[model samples]
Target: MSEHHELILTCPKGLESLLAEEAGGLGLEDVREHTAAIVGHAALEVAYRMCLWSRLANRVLLVIGRFPVTDAESLYAQVHAVDWREHLEVAGTLAVEFSGRGSGIDNTHFGALKVKDAIVDRLRDAGGLRPGIDKLNPDLRVHLRLDRGQAVLSLDLSGHSLHQRGYRLQQGVAPLKENLAAAILLRAGWPRIAAEGGALADPMCGVGTFLVEAGMMAADMAPNLRREHWGFSGWLGHVPALWNRLLAEAQERAAIGLARPPLWLRGYEADPRLVQPARNNIERAGLSSWVRVYQGELATFEPHPDRNQRGLVICNPPYGERLGDEASLLYLYQHLGERLRQVCLGWEAGVFTGAPELGKRMGLRSHKQYAFWNGALPCKLLLFKVDAGQFVTGERQPVARDTGQATPARLSEGGQMFANRLRKNLKQLSKWSVREGVGCYRLYDADMPEYALAIDIYQDWVHVQEYAAPRTIDPAKAQTRLLDALAAIPLALEVMPEKVVVKRRERQSGKRQYERQGSEGHFLEVREGGARLLVNLTDYLDTGLFLDHRPMRRRIQREASGKRFLNLFCYTATVTVHAALGGARQTTSVDLSKTYLDWARRNLALNGYSERQSLVQADVMEWLEKDSGEYDLIFIDPPTFSNSKRMEGVFDVQRDHVRLIDLAMARLAAGGTLYFSNNFRRFALDCRLLERYTAEEISAATIDEDFRRNERIHRTWRLQAGKTR
Candidate 1:
């Protein structure tokens, strides 16, 4: 074993090159990459040093023996022959972890059991005492691997998986493991990007894992900067001085980075729930000031305000396996592609998804395609290059309906009739808003004129209003007329060529943010089922609160009483006042935007209940890390898109919803219920993802009177603690 004199380090697959570079940087010699290992010949201290400073590797393994084995008995015999006394005391506790591929040893558990028996038996026979098994915390950790009749035994220098970087005080759903995140950064050649001052962005960043990992990589900060302990620290051969020196050296290198925002780094998630956790992770990684997490819809992500072109945007959007259907995922991808081509010019893009078919929807040719494993699922990292100059930013062309024998002119005639009606309605709306003290007005004519499309933005209820037209008509003509009038409006508002969302007009088309503003504030009111609601007419194309969740708000008024309430991503605080009036003991509202959070406070005061509510102007995800307060009633309604100047970056609802839901459930009081809603029309809830909590679909209860044309406006859900797995 001593004569072999070579060190083989185990890293999460695909990070071998990074580990090799780290070893070389530490002055180790003969660095080479293997499938999941980095092999090099170095002094024993180099192995010890790697355990302290190498952030990309999972463990620094001190290889004890490598031999061929065909059976458990042979493996046991070989394991027994090792000098156990050198690594573990007779009375010490030891744990064995085994991984095998192909070969005769098919069961990893059985292999582990055999190795444990051999180690204990050999030690007992030699010293009259056997080491104890300590699975949770052990004095010695041994890793055994059998690959196609070849066996390797090594001491696990870093225990508990180096991915536990010790900085994660909290997390959201399917969080990228630290090691995995590091591998992703390494794969992206982050060091090279950072060196060039290239920007890093995660449009669907969850808990800021990717952003934090990228920041650490760019700054050359050790991945274990926050780690308090390592498995190697307990080894009999551990050198405390060397470990301390490595850590100090890494810290000194980080200090030289100046703590400046790398060329650029940002993350966006539509769900406000992830905004807080992502901020928490970034801060934990000492990247709070360097990385930003924004809570808003992807459609609203405008990287450049005046100039429409900008930097790279990367995302790890959810594959249907753990989230929802491929069809919905495809829509998200198509929408993302449309946005990317329109807004992000002269930029590069990378999308990691398990579903390859979905990648085709992006309509961009792959510059590079990499195979990666997100846990057990094989995923593809498809890279695309976008031309900022040639990007097309416009609404999607409507799909022709299979209306048999409908003449082309027949369709055009219907469209023209609808356009004329819309022109008339807009004229009336313009006159009414001017006369009725309104700024914007809703027009029944939009992408489809045969539909009841109400436009509003007249009054203060841009805070919460809806455009409700009492008549139902064909949607195609309405949509065309709506866009025509929008094009004709003399508003001086900035319209991002890439931010326009065009759809076939589903009965439930509330996915993207459709907001437009006129120099004048105008809104339209649609009365139906005895409810008259005003819609945002000027500041945005659509009103803020989807009017469909009106029932859920009413439910809050019906059920809230003497309970503490929490509203995450509290846009206009419509639900905050609802809970407060329902008699909540105290309400804490969270959102990234001070503008919206302040609006929520005003809404509460407007309803005569100000003393009972508190507004927190921070990312809810980050705030949850330091917040342990539980609430009896919680409302988590996040935006479809927002680019808050106060936040880190942008957000996408479909990508961040699962984790957001889980975290909200974590803070619920015993017997507490949380109302989580989203307007992403194509959103499909992953029941398996929320197996730890019981969820009931309250979509029916959330729909209000004015929003009956589309039933899926908002989804209300109740969660309780339970074992999902």
Candidate 2:
């Protein structure tokens, strides 16, 4: 073995520059950056230092050999050419991690197996004893990268990826990896801020990744100081004396750092469930005194008054990826910008998000932007100075006078009519809502042709969905009417401007209707017919709970005592919850979307429903085909047109209702009733099927007072399995 070995430190893609800077800071020689790895030459002591301190590197590998190979036989021969006894003992375990492709080795698993065979065969030939394979905790980890006809093999000095600092035991969805988090901090210039005695905060922190990493950097603590396992611990060339010396030095430095006053490191999460995990992670990292996590909303987040120094407010907010709604997310981004401009006037900001367009909605010009990859999703790290002058002011102006009284904005004839109609509708619905005990219902549904919008009130929140204007209408006129309606909503409805969410609703086909409209995962509890449901004002095109279903839910509660209930295409299972609360014997809800199924489970749990209620994530049609159990009552309300990739086939409610109804009738107990509904306006039932089973049209009966003006909102039918009436 050479006294100085060439090392390759692999990291996530787009982080090569940070890794190179870190390697150079460590005083390594010939540091060079590649696509996703850094190459450098250093002695054994330097490699040990890197293993203990390099937070941006995923793995630190020591290059042992390189050769040219064309086929699997050549690969085996080249691998066998190395003496395995020098790296691992015959009694030890080994693991091979093969990456890259080409040169007759296309499958990574096959390549790894061949490499393993070569090493075991060489060891057996030398001493007639072969090492066992341990994938989880290997004594020696061999890495092979094959490109073109070249093969490079290295010994992984870090047993696991360096990102696994052994601090995180729990994380929220789509968590930022530790290495990536470190890279973000480096880009945010946290070291400079720390030197100036400034604080760090992540308003939307998930499990405190940023806070922990920032605390470690500020305190000058080694990243892997708490780790107990390393690849070199069991290797043949293990240097116990050198490792012990490095460990002692790190411990002394950490002790000295811990003796000093703690830095201001804080995190705020909206979800209460995530706050405890962050606290646990911080405590485990020995940063409890420095890092503090609180359950807080973004609207109320502010810098601590005790920390008077200017610092950094960095966050990785939801990117509205799976949640396709961008309109609602714009409001959140705008609010973030407002908060930064108002509260963090002198601070710096870094927002890492996959949606740069949404970042633009912040209304603040980013001075610097860096492109990075968040697990194959290209994202940008937007840096802002957070100066008041940088904020684009006058973006919003008061539509009313400063007299502190409600006054309508002066508008054109069309806009005035729109505004007047909105106020009139609010007056009418306020009385009805109070009498009906409805906290969420539609107030206005495009009452006038010029003003095309659907305004729904969820208690204090107002949701306005603007219908896309026809081509005959001028776009400018439509936009003006929309602005007028937005201005009138908050005043007429007596709600805060921030509580109003607006989305444009167009004629959607296929799966477009189900796509997300935003990433604001804000859920509010609303009451409907003695059942409490969780409805998200932002995020999806439709709220989790359908307002029009209030009547149907009440009907189910009225008829569901001691009856077995089944709900197909059960979105959020609101009806099932009502049935269960109505004392149903058992309730089963089926849907294809895991997102909705999880939501349904939460809704059930919110209402204190027990395990007697079941939620299944499956295509409703497929499940119907396989189900044999009979139910006393069933509810089926499917989308008008759905081509979800998760479904077995395209479903058009008009085309498939007959087949779907027949399938449901097969499982419908004798004398049981089946409620079938669809929102397709032009749908017409097959009269021939009515000859076999008794049927009645309940569309008019199901229309609530809020939707009485528009009876075509949804059509419902009640069918019985006995005989024709």
Candidate 3:
């Protein structure tokens, strides 16, 4: 027991390198990255520093034991062999967490229970007292990670997940975890850039996680400064004087580095609600003095006033999965291009997105695209060089639409009949909404038959939404059906230069055409919906809008009765038209870019509601802070990411979701509902923080055909009545 000395510190999966870096920075020798663990050898001070400074680690583990265990009995034997009295006292509460794969110990819960029982039984047999289990707040947390036949046990130094940086008192929709945010920064080369006067930004800086993380990095501030509980506090070897000395040294390092501020660490968001939360989060991180938060739209944001410094802009934009249509996201990216070219000169920009088709719309030539996992979904972090003179013009060569034959797949007569039924229902819904003055109609024609597609008909534009499985065999077949569904609407497919967005499951051999242009505006016309507004279905794949929000559109149709409606970050004004037709007295749409406002107006005119609507090309939050307009109904669906130049900085939906909802609720009428939605897959509503308002999750109500019943589009809820202090 005394001779064997090997410890492995486990962290989040992708952050192995960061933990290794932390270990090395703290003077720990022989640090190496293994799967999800950082293997290192260090004295107690090195562990203390790692606990104090690492921004991307969940917990700093002091590896105490590693042994081979084929079953639960062996696990117990190995755990009991270590003298429990050396560390944990009989009176101390302890918890065990197990994570692993492929072993007889298949169940994590059972494994954890077995370990706990072993520890307690050993302590009781030796010391004659059994420590109680404290699930919510434990005295010590023991982590066990099993790989193959080996079991590695370590003492967790950092309590809870390190990503739960105390800075975030508030959260937004599907906000990026702090550790993940830090990992992204490290991946983008932010530390070196910050040292060299490079600006760091998140256009959609939801709750300002990226910006705050960047600021903390720039200021050399520890991510765990505000956290009080660390597993080390419960350890017998914890040294108070040494900890104080380490903290004082860290503070001194920050002070020494504070002589000159890093260049432009900023965030920009369109939702007015995000502004205060961003401010609060940045302030909590001790980055208020180092970082700047602007409540503005990304589309029209201008470059920083200081012309000498070139900046690095990073955006995590909405991928049309949760918020709105994919076509409108393209519009958002179109303005993004305009802003990037006009303002971000000699700068490097990186966009982290789970959607590849959406990235193409940015119109910038990507220099490098890295495959990464944003949770379980495979995403790409695309890096681009913003050359103002060279790639300023958003130019693209149009390819001809493929008239080539598709491989035959058996679509039986019964399958075709079911598809026809779905198409008919879609046509019926479209006609009813158009005739009833609803500008946006959620048509379910594509949903009932089997293809995971949602069809929405906007007077002039048709949105086709598609969901492909995790592994797709034939992407062309999927794309073809998507195009065929769009063509079934009778709108001649006029493929935009950057329109065809292909998401390939795996790399395929041979040539593949991704885009086409100058296609005929005429197509096979079919009137399935009640409205006779010419159904111009094209032969190309989806280009109009995303269709998952069909239920949300229906909700808008139901709720827009005799109310004044305001749409924040309004892309193409689909909801605006719905509200207008629902008897909304006046509709005001606010976005940062004039381009989107233009598209919004076009969408409104397509539905014949242009005269009743007003478009304001300004940051919605800034406009709300300045303007005193009250609305009966307000729809706040912000982009997942936006880093615009006309505005001061970037914005994030997850970090800013709660605050945006609060702000919208503040401006809402006495009995109005602020319908706030974001497409963040893991969006968690901070219900406790918003106790002043009544909120109910409407994620179920927002689902459509393109999104399977189990697939959630955006987590939504209705907020009414302000909280009473």
Candidate 4:
């Protein structure tokens, strides 16, 4: 067991060549690289050296035996042929792990059981107490790799994964694994930088993994010097004096490395909550004198290198992993790129991200990109030399900041509080939204009285309406709070800040609500209830679709199949789109404005509706009087009041609803349904309608969970031909 042993050093994929190079430098000969591991011939001391210093390895395995096997019996027989007494004591604990699935063993657990039974039986035959089972902290860990009718068994020389450098007992969300960090640093050429006395910094150093790793590399400290437990500590073939001599040399080298003046190493994390944890990690790594952690943001991240000094800027920015969160993360990547270009000029940079497309959005041309896997996620490491030529300072497209299911790195106190409320709403509504196939919905509606903002999510965009503050409240304070809410919208919703379109909403008496707010004229398509419609978030005060009317649109969709449908006061004709998609026989929509009628034309075309649908441009009250069309299904959602030039007089919902209902019901065929709704908070239903038509109050049912907080947003009723009495 002593002359020369076969060693397999396992690392993550993409690190095989690096592991082979490092293993060769550490007294290993005839090294051959494989997919995720490297095999070489080395003495037991060389294997011990790798376990102590090879930062990129997951496990340092000593190959004990290899044999041919085609079945469980052969596997057990081969494992039993090994002299277990040479490795594990009879009183010691052991665990077995089997990888690959072939040779009549489909389950890894079952294969491991067979191996364990063989080892136990052989140890028991040798007399003394048989080894007990220990999965965690086992004195010996046995691994078998099953390939095409062949089994290669080995003993794990590293107890826990070598990445568990004993420093990061706690970590930030999505922390980059430590060994991967070291490999990244190596690829970024940090070893040479350290040799030249160069510095290193990570702006988004979560739990200080990168900073601690750099500190150790710069100080020549073995990555596992402080690790107390090891797989070879209790192994029967262990040599104590040889191990101590190597350990003494590593200690002497570490002292000389640390005795020099420390490099200018710094880390800045945006999350204040992570600052202490990061500092604690640096302290645990015994490099607190050389490394420091600070609470700072990417916007203000400036590595305090001395004048005429340059260093590497490294970060692992968030790659959003939720539905709308990726759009928001673009800003984060752009922000990182901007900081690198603006401040760290003439320095090198490396950014690791799971989203390569977002990395491309950074507006920096990377000289090189390395692919790596974070668990099952494929990621890229973008390498940049932060020079003026590499920086693309062209006018950047406006990027917004939206958070994902995971919390964003930073938020203001007020923003955090408001974001918490928004997160609660999103968590509550996400399941229903996904189940109901809703891509757009009202996310917030002034749930907190101070922030009188109604927020809606249109896929990845956020639409915010700041309800005009009342005279009783301080206008300045109200505006400040509104700004806070607006700022919080993008962060909470995981949307780009520019994607948040905000407008002030007050009592619009006439066509003021329909007036254009901006000339951006750009439209975004949103999906709901199987229909897709265009919403002008910037141009119009209201997004082309009303979120509160979602349930009502769904109701029309379910009942409109094979029925003649009519929509009155159809501003953008969104309801007509739903009806047409729901299989309506024919649809007729009436509105006064030519602009809205043109918009209705586009809405009809968007849903592939042409011949069977008609759009009328006359004023609705005037058109209804002359129309002779009969509709089996009808819907009327009138504004609170209208003062348009097309109308003869000011039309108010409370004052003119009875006359309006009479006109709409005249167009309803026998045994037809007329759904009438209005947003007039103070309007009262007339007792006269109860006698003229059968009325069923559907105000409660039409309002969904999102609008339940403020049911006064609208009221509705289903009217037929008969009266209640």
Candidate 5:
């Protein structure tokens, strides 16, 4: 049993090299790294020592036999060939775990059953009692892995994953496994820092995982010393005397390490709910004196250590899964950067995040980046050396009371890339805006697939709408790229963060487009086509004025000279105001909602034409059927879908567009034209309507230079009475 035998230490992916190094340090011979595992040769006592000490391994296995396996029968025969009596008693309870797939053993359950049956039949055939299966508490745990028609059967030395550590009883949301946390600390050079007795802090620590792990490492405590049971305890190969000697030595070393002065290890969590849980976990880990946690906000998270003390700042901050969520996470990362710059000078920062691009929002350049896997998702650890000499956007200068010179913040590489694109778009569109005297235009329309966002400029304020990403793309990745673009917005436009408004854009079925996104009734006035429009950029999903139809509004302005104008489905009546600007004699606008009719009233009042314009708050379809009104010029722009309670039936633009256009045409006078438009991406003009009316498709001319990239922004057509003009 004391003879050197092959042992394997399995770890999380990306930590194989680290595990091999640790195995060599643990006195294992011929240590080598493999895929998600480390292979070495060690005596039974050395394997026992590793089971009690190794921090970065999930499991430790002792190889017993390796034999050729072709099918379930061959797998059973090979497993039965092993000397079962030498490992466990014939009546002992056992569990079989199988991994990999090949040679007719397609699944783990079937493979495990074959191994179990083989062991049971072999023991019984030897004139001994049959062993029973005990998955939870087994006297022997057998692990089998099939690779290239070979089965490597082994006895599990560590029953459960070594990462259990038996310290963290309660955890916060998205908790990092104990082994992964140790690997992160090692990568961050925490052992060297701990030996020097430097302070450690986690600003966004949840349940104090890093603090507890760092505390144990600094105190020289064995990770699995407190584990009462192990896979070798019930095996015949276990040497109790050797294990006892190693345990005593570990206990003595822990006592010696704990006698020294405690290092400053502190954690701050933004959630008040997690503060108590973090404290409990710290106390359970016997680190109450060395580690502590407090309820704190990221913006005000300040860790005060002793003088002349510099340490590592490590944290795994909260992340999001949706594109619009970047608005807040972007600021979260920025706040961390601000804190690092303001207070953590001469310190090292290790930021672990699943959304790697969000790491760019911190503005601090990382000297080194290490890739690690957090389960199935890949994450990055950005190592930054906080110093005065490493700023690109410069430091925050003091603001004067009169001048109001706000602090200038730096953009990260990704943020800078997006900012440059925004600047390029603005530079090209500025000439068009100056020539047309247009105050609102689309600055960007998802020019970069990485940054799937539409950025619009309302004179000085910026309006950004995020289109939901596809289902196939990872939400975490989409959100990180989104953070990059959002972090660049204010920097690119040289505007305040408050001036940038963000909203999500999707297919609106009913009155959802007009639904209030916020209660703040703030309004901003922007100009278009020589007309001043009132836009509530903060109060709704839409900013009241549709910038994509800028040229179409101008077309209406030029075509409505001395003609009676009628606007159907008139949302906010911005086009009606343009019609009134073109010397229209009288104009009537119809809508279903009283809120919009009131808004239309305010729009007309803003233009000083209350008498000539009329705002009716009736359902356009129902009202058009009842009215006997005729106009020289008319416009119809309907919603893609509407199921409002007041409306008699649901309205779908694709299904009921033909009926809608014919009703609006009834109100058009002879020789007058009806201009129709809708923003549906898949909108197709009805051939039935085309057969009845002389229609001229003008979709291309309606879209201006700013919206030319997204030709599907909206469709427009000019229609007149009769099949032949």
Candidate 6:
């Protein structure tokens, strides 16, 4: 092996330039950037330095040879031509990683097998013991890349990718890879910021990836210094003396860097469960004194009083990937922008997100943007200079301002009366909520027709749904009144303005009800009937847990014990969750919407009710016709009208109730009870259903105290098998 060898350093796509710069900094010669990788020539010491220090690279490969090959036979010949004794001992273990196609090699597995066979045959022909193949921890790792008729073979010198920095033993949801985090920090100019003795903060740091990477950079700590294994550790060509010298140098540098005054590093996460993992990762990186992670909400995110205030605030916030996610994220982005503008005035900000549209919702103009790949997802890092001049007005329409400290919007004549009405309703409902142990319930449901809106409380969070004003009303006047109402609710309810979420509710035909209105996919857990369910106040028209169905859910909890429970048209399966918690023998929840099904699965899993719960994504009508097994207890709550493309046909609860009931009856065991419910305001039960079964209208009984003022919100019926008419 030559003392100077051409090396290839692979990194995540879009990071080739940064890797090239890093190689140049490490004193590698002739550095050139390629797609997703860098090519350079360096002595053995530089390769060892890269393996130990380069934070932006995935793998450091030492090129062994290049050859022209047209088929498997030629590939074997070329691979066998390498003197195996020079790299790997005959008894040592080896693994081959083959990539690319062409030259008749279409499958990577077959290519790897051919390469392995050639190496083994070469050793055997020399009358030496054949090498064993150990894919997990091989003594020598060979990489083969075939393009056209040329093959370039290299030996991986980093064991695993260099991104495995030996710090992250635990992780939060959808964590960013270490190398990707390093690239983001580099692109955000964290190096310069840290060098200037500025602080660093990640408000949404999941498991502290950015903070750990930033701490490493600030302290000049080699990323792989903690790692005990290396690809060249057992390789025959490894120069142990030179490697030891480099390792000692890195250790000395790290010691001096660690003794320097710690950089101001901190992270904030909303989920308490994630904060410990961040701390664990930071401690594992030997950076406990340099970094701190606290469990705190975004609205409370501010620079630490004791740390440097002006620096960089970088985050990879949740990019809405599923239905209802985008709608909730809009508010999050807006809040983030507001916090940066109001609190961290001089800090530079970078937001990495897959949804660029959501980034625009931040209301801060990005001065620079860089495209990056988060695995297969194409994303952008939006950079902003957090100053007053960079703050733009949010997308929310102008509303009357009432920050809870000012004279309430009710000071005006019309606004005063509206505010009085809300106060009265809250007074009435507050007592009921406490007595019933209900953390969430409808507080006001259009008590005064002139100020038509529905106000619901989820713990400390308030969700206000404004009934769309009639077309005959003046648009500007209606908007003014709506804003006034919004301003009054938070003041009268005594909740923070940031905790209030508002949406416009309109009459919908077809799939309009499920259409996304915003990108603030935030869900809050509220308790009802001994069950915990997630309710998203910002995403969809209806929160995942329907407040109007509280009584029905309680009823199911009471009657579902020891029965086979089935829920049809189960939008989020709140009823099924209650039933399962009530000790039902088994539960099957069917819904056509995959979005709601996922929500239901999460709800059930959240309550520790996992075993007997089944969430099926299927049209309830079709599923009912196909299911032959009878359920001891059944609940059917279909939408008023749905013409979803996924449905076999349009569904109208009014016109289809009889047939729907009949199909449901066929799946009900003898003496079983089936509860039917719908939100069609003018719905009437067909007399035919009464004739075929003993049916009784349970609408009034199902309307809890919170919804007593709006009896027409939904209707319910309970039926049992009986003599036919």
Please give each candidate's TM-score: 0.52, 0.68, 0.59, 0.62, 0.72, 0.65
The prediction achieving the highest TM-score against the true structure is 5
Worst 10 residues of 1 by lDDT: 403-412
Q: Relative to the true structure, how large is the alpha-carbon lDDT of every model? A: 0.65, 0.85, 0.67, 0.85, 0.86, 0.85
lDDT of each residue in 210-277, candidate 2, tens digit only: 99999999888999999989988888877999989999999999988877888788899999999999
How many clashes does each candidate structure show, in the order listed?
71, 5, 54, 8, 0, 11
Output the worst ten-in-a-row residue range by lDDT, candidate 4: 400-409
Error of 5 at 244 (Å): 3.0
Note each model's CA RMSD in angstroms.
18.5, 8.9, 20.5, 18.3, 8.2, 10.4
Give the clashing residue pairs of candidate 4, or none: 400-496, 400-497, 401-496, 401-497, 402-494, 402-495, 403-494, 694-722
Q: What is the C-alpha lDDT profile of model 3 across 183-247, one tens digit per residue?
A: 77777778888878787767778788888888878887777877878886876656789899998
In angstroms, how far off is 409's CA in candidate 2? 18
- Model 3 bad stretches (over 4 Å): 1-5, 101-104, 125-128, 388-725
Give the lDDT of residue 143 in candidate 4. 94
Tens digits of lDDT, candidate 4, 130-221: 99998988889999999898889999999889999899878898888899999999988899888887889899888999899999999999
The runs of at least 3 residues in candidate 4 whose Cα sits more than 4 Å from the true structure, single-residue gaps closed, are 125-128, 394-673, 676-725
The CA lDDT at 408 in model 2 is 27
Error of 1 at 693 (Å): 55
Q: Candidate 6: minimum summed lDDT over ten consecutive residues — where? A: 403-412
Better of 3 and 4 by lDDT: 4
lDDT of 1 by residue, 409-507 (tens): 111334345545646655655565455343333334233423334433333221212233335544443434433333222121122222222222223
The predicted structure with the larger lDDT, 4 or 6, is 6
